[model samples]
Target: MGSCIICGTPVEGRICDSHQEDVVFEFRGNEASQLTPGRFYSGAVDGYADFGVFVDLAPGVTGLLHRSELDRRLESLDWEPGDTVFVQVKNVRDNGNIDLGWSIRQSERDFRGALVQDADGDHEDDESDESDDAEAEVETPTVRHGSASRDESDESNESNESGKSNESNESGKSNESNESRHQRDEAEPEPSADRERVEIGTLGDRVGEEVRIEGEVVSAQQTGGPTVFEVRDETGVVDAAAFVEAGVRAYPDVDVGSVVRLDGEIELRHNEIQVETEALVSLEGDDADTVQSRLDDALRGRARPDEVTPLADHDAIVSVGTQLQDAAEEIRRAVFESRPIIVRHTTTADGYVAGAAVERAVLPLIREEHAKSDAEYHYFDRRPLEEAVYGMDAATNDVTRMLQDRDRHGEKLPLVLLVGTGATVESSDGLDLLSIYGAKRVVADAAAVDAEIEESTDVLVSPVLADADASDLSTGALVANLAAAVNDDVRSDLRHLPAVSYWEDAPQAYLDAASDAGYDETYVRELREAIALEAYYQSYEDKRELITDLLFDNGVTPDGDGENAGNLASHVSEQFRLKLDAEVETARANLESREADGVDFAVLDTDAYTHRFDFPPTALLLDELHRREREGDTFVTIGVAMDELYLRSTADVDLRAVAEAAREHAPEAGITAVGIREGRIEFLSGRREQVKEAVVEAVAEQLA
Candidate 1:
């Protein structure tokens, strides 16, 4: 029996079965089957392949280290042929193929002990000879007692041999101990003051050279090999990879948004400049405060515009500049903190255009802020709602997704941005649900805002509340300005989007801005028609990338076919006009024109006259039909449904006033203004005929 080297427990060999894995072994077997599974072995690099590397364990035995087992990218490996490495034996296949897994520690000194595994599946510790010598010494006393003075010269010879064996074992152990200590010392890097501090933007000039940098950590993630910290200084952001112990987290205290001082060498990683951090320390006390202040100052100077610039020369836009600034700041802070931003917009051409503009501006910022290439997709999302109201259904879906992301990925709660939606009283309940979980809400809609909605959201940008004509502005125009405030770089790209939202009669200022940005009138018209057609097909999807291309990309393809931008728009717009014309003709033929309560009324049973499941939606169809029918007459067009009604008027009409009158006139029917800006009303389905009669009379009285 012998004592285990690690735990000092008695065992059959120098180490117990439990401690076998703790010790690394030098394999001396000549066959692959001689190696034990789940044991670490010392090997030398035989060669490399696109899929994996080949490691030689013995003279003629080798194993394949598949690329999937690698901690980092296969190409990042610096190992050369014949270089000593450590790998774990994962399996020995039935066909004698050896599979090797990656090991963090490449040196035998990193393990508790070293052993030699023979071809017979037996382990021999390097110190086993010393233990044998000690046993001989113990028995020598017994021999002396048995034969007091007999064979003293033989005993002396035996004692000398034992002493030499012990000396050899002690010397080997000492060398291993020294090597381990040296490796540990080398792993801990000391910060040097002699290194010059450089901005991240200037790292291109310092590649392959040592550098010192101080910045705020934008994000941090632990990969198998190192903890990658994305630090943003005044100039720009760069990734710093700090590896203390391979596959172990280093600088455990450094977190996202923390101010840190790092010393490292700049190396090109995957063709991008990255700092392989040698020393990383989180600043504390006055140092931390100073670094934070410096970052804040720089962010303010760069992120915030000198003054709020209105997109158009309008009183309402000028008045809402402060609110726009607040919305922009919230978005910028979310990006800095690595919180996901969720945009909720109505499923309309104007709404999609508005959301896509913001998506374009914010995605670039997310990419710049995160080290991972897929960060933009993970951190920013846009969901389209079927209606212009943020109801319980939309709120429930948002909360579910946010909770899932938070639990599964440890993501921060997102910022819920309601673009071209959520400015009505009906959306307050949905906004409140988001607030219960500490999600920030911002509303940017060119709609008549309700007082309750302004209170429910953190920031509300509604020009109608500032006495602006809601009819003169499109939601796309309003949110395009908000997107510009969030990211100034995309401001020019969004110049044409606002004008494209209007089917006709866009504001002169927006048209001029679009022209200045090189989008002619014909281009704007085609883009608008394309978006309108696309919005009707997949009313739920945001179509983020495709819409961005159609709206912003120049009309030139790599093949020079001039079929990139306007090609899709031209084809889709033709379908839109044809389908819409057919629907309008059907609706007009079914229209019942009459005079009710001294008012001209145009009423149509939309459920029977229009294709509810195809082409333009009920709200959009009513809007166009009303605009074309009510040329000079001050009339009200009503698209009546079983349980709801969509209204359009030549003169300004208050749907809420009509809803209140209908409730009184038809006491048994429950009526409410579901979409105020859309001029929509909902009533109990059971009281359909009674509610219709009451609603027509009430609207006529209000118009009168």
Candidate 2:
């Protein structure tokens, strides 16, 4: 038994099974059965197919590397036939069919050791023989186009090799290690004439050709093998790998957001083009300014649309459309810059529908901007808040996650988005936290916002600030407009969301738009109820696929188009009605009648009489209860829990003014208004009885 080269542990081969993936292999066998899974092997592109590509491991042996096994799109690959590449053998079936997977490490020099494999057995590579016939397909040194000619470099290397000690020459060790040579070479800048600068997007076509690339380092990640730098130019981004030692960071001076010029040879790694870096240096002066200007101009042209096209004919929405366009541009810019987005919304139907609509639109844009298929998940996130308040806990959680990501993956700070929330004074502290860390904050709400909120947020798109009627729009309706502006391809899918958002009276234009989009009134209503019910159970989870299915991708339903399957929304809506009816009935049984200041009040002790955590919460139950208790001309329904109470009134209710007046009546109750739109107030539970009565009297007197 030999010792594993990596950890010095005993193994059956030169590399232990645990560390086998770290070692790459050269296959000499002519049969597929001799190939071992989990170890990477050198291969050449035989050809492509509709489903995948065929990689030739040997003269007569080949393996199928399916398109799904790739980290990037199949069409994006620029490899011509007979190009040397690397892939892992995933499986060798009984029928002699071989399956290959992607390998992140493309070059044999990147691994600590390269092993030789054959039908006989596995052994270490013997580089001294240098047999052209036996290993006819051995690696060829990539030629640097404009640098020292191949003849000169070979002569210089041979002279240096001849001067080396006899022991070092026989052992096959170089005079200078690759890392020290790379460090020395990178210390000096080469003349611009030595290499032609190339755009990152064109690197795929220039594989094995040495060139210089200039761009900003967007991300610098360190792996077990190499330090990978993601450089973004105006056209696109490409990974540049630099190696000093195993698990050691290369070019530590080069960091994220730095504009640098990288000199390297292009190679295909895992079907995606990567740069094997020889030298990387930061660019400054006119060159840096030129690159920065080009990137900014390109970003503005590609990320921002000229104008916002409202899906429906609504004057109120149009009046505030420009601001929505600005918010959309910011969101698009974040995606292009490879920044993560945290979309926080309330746990209501309007919040879920709004978040889902924006999510659907943003996801496709992420896929288009990034080469990786799973970039959508890494770039875009939708988090639901338990309440509308974005407090310390939420902001702290966001900070913790962002810091961890930055340290581990060299990612940029995320953009914190508040949809249908973060417009109140309650959200100020959270916004402050995000601002301190330079995280962009956006508030796209339809409710009246505190004056302080507008000044603090990066982008605040609200009817309250736009001088329009806030009552005419629901949060979902307003944010759906924003979602459409983010991605116009998804505009048709969001037409019915506005109609679905309204519980009672929706704007006629939105209703007409939903009808035009083939969603009848009944269907939208059922969908709204279903989202409301589902959104409540998992109040914190994103439930991305489930929401997508309900909104767009659910299979053929009985009431929906095509052959009959089943309508998921209608079945879920049925439960919504049943549960809501039960809660409202229970609330009505404990209702107390009160008459003061010419107002009739229907009050219920929520903590003592109703289910706390179940469906049809205080707000929904009180809404239904107030609609039923129409015994008087002016009626008010109040649900009082241990420390909080909800108010719904037929009369005008100014929550802030009522809160100030209520605090006066109960001086030590410590009462405050949580949500102005919802008429929610919180107080000391020890003084609940006095606080509830005080609020009722204060509100009644304000209207009286």
Candidate 3:
């Protein structure tokens, strides 16, 4: 039988060989076990070593107890390197290296002492006997270690005792050296600060310094003080103040659960850390939110150079913003750090108010960008626009009904935009007119444009056309300021188009948007070079000499008369091609570049998150309403689909009142404006403006 390396005893029968490589395994240090791959251990030792000792954790599981694992103390002679050790398995290597650990340094000390006393000098029995009572009399010692700082003497002892080996008269001492390590099992430690209190100095000594101190609240009395309070950190407590405080005044009224930091001097009273007469703040607030704010304030005050350093690892951070400028900055920072950021908008009133203001004020600045683009802009709406269309149901007569009703021939449609009258311009000047019209119309969605374009049939003027390059400069590119100045629809339209500027005389701010686009460099170069040269232009006599010069040199001149339909068609085709090419290039580059390593950048599919909304828990009250309807106990008994009910769940409206209103309005055919999520219905007015108000008021009244 192979000898157990740990206990120096021979093994019997089939040796249990655990074939787990790199897996942590624990066993008694005294067990007879052979060294094998895939097992690690930690334990008490029975001997000392110059290098390290062999610890046999179990049958076929042995690890080295290196001298580097010994504890502090020049006088420590309890354990030897090769003797039986009470250990914990950490990791087992393939090449037979076993990482071991000990819960307490005393274990190793006791084990080493046992081995030293047992070692035989010429007389083997003397070594073996060692007055058996001596082994029985040794008591196991206990110790604790944590992140908290320890006594300087303890560290000094460890450093000094690292040299030297315990010599024995029996067999020559083992070769392994020893080092000290302390480990603790996962368990809540009992509080022991009451037994002995340590005096750690005042703020000056503790500000940048770290010390362990325990204190008791003598009195948590509050005063009508400023919006500042004192709370304790590990080192000490400090006064935490804030800008807002009218609500916090009385201290005795505060709850006992409130824990505050002390700011100034630490007065030792009755052998406990205590402080008095400092600023006080209430930790108690409405809920967790108040606590979180207090804690955040404390953390901000207590932040130190060391704590700020990430502990080698941590979870990623997250930030949120609804404004484009703020979002862009946040995104840029996240990208720089190579950290993933989950963004969400804070649906507070500030965001909506600011968004509405931005929508109204910024679009006007870039009026030229939306000229020709078939893009659509979406402005911030206090309520969903879809709801507004359904709110216009007050009218009774046919004409009024037609105007008020969202449903026309069972087709639930929304409001029609009242576009300004078309301008009359010659075919040559038609370019400017088309540019102006397109700039205004393009930012609107394809659906909105299609609807509006179909209703109007009269043509007051022929189409004015410009070369492809001039087309963008003359009419396209609605700036944020200019777009925001017009109606909400105009703002929505501007969001859909790219900003472009052709003439040097164009708005400087509008040109900035074009320059921001990736293609601006190419456009700028062509315009400058062509404008300086005479050969690029066919005639200076042409009313559009400057336009001709810019276009011909830039290869933007059409194949037919500048006003011809063929020219307009060609220009549109060229613009489409250029846009398509740019989009394709961007896609190809994204696909070709390597994404961040080890990070899966897949977008979370939202199909599952939607299921929660689809299946809401049945409230007893709602069930009662449904039962009443079934029994014909309720009026009108309007029937809504499952999704509508689900959408209404998040709404402020009362379900019972909505049901009652629907029942009452069903006969009169009072309109029910379905939300955007509804597939069959489209409201006429802005959903947010009209429908949301009615639904909220009606539901809230009923619920109340």
What local distance difference test score does each model get? 0.73, 0.76, 0.26
Which of candidates 1 and 2 is the stronger one according to TM-score? 2
Better of 1 and 2 by lDDT: 2
Q: Write the residue-wise lDDT of candidate 1 on 1-704 in tens digits.
A: 77564445667766677656656777888888889899888899999987899999998889999987875546657899999888999999998889999886553323545667877555554354454354345311211110111122112111000001111132244212444445444455556678767888788788888888998875564332244567777666777766432222345556666788888777764456777777777788998898778777877765555556766665556777887888888888778666789999887789888998889789888877664455676679899888888989999999998885553233578999998789988888999999999999999988757866887999888876566656677889888888888888888888888888887788889899889888889878877777887887767766665576577665322222333433666666678888888999999999999887677888889888988888888888888888888845568889988889998888778889999999999988889899986788999889988888898899888877
Model 2 has an lDDT value of 0.76
Candidate 2 ranges with C-alpha deviation above 4 Å: 1-198, 201-212, 263-273, 554-565, 630-633
Q: In candidate 2, how many clashes are counted?
A: 0
Scored against the true structure, residue 353 in model 1 reaches a CA lDDT of 84
Q: Kindly list the per-residue Cα lDDT of model 2 for residues 595-623, writing each as its tens digit.
A: 88889888999999889888977777787
Candidate 3 residue-wise lDDT, 257-366, digit = tens: 35432222333322223232222333333533554464445434432111111111111100000122222222222221111211111111111112222333322322
Q: lDDT value for candidate 3?
A: 0.26
| lDDT: the better of candidates 2 and 3 | 2
**What's the distance in Å from true for residue 642, model 2?**
0.7
Give the residue spans of candidate 1 off by over 4 A: 1-196, 243-252, 336-339, 363-375, 403-411, 469-471, 515-522, 554-566, 631-633
TM per model? 0.69, 0.73, 0.17
RMSD of 3: 29.7
**Which candidate should be chosen as best, given lDDT against the real structure?**
2
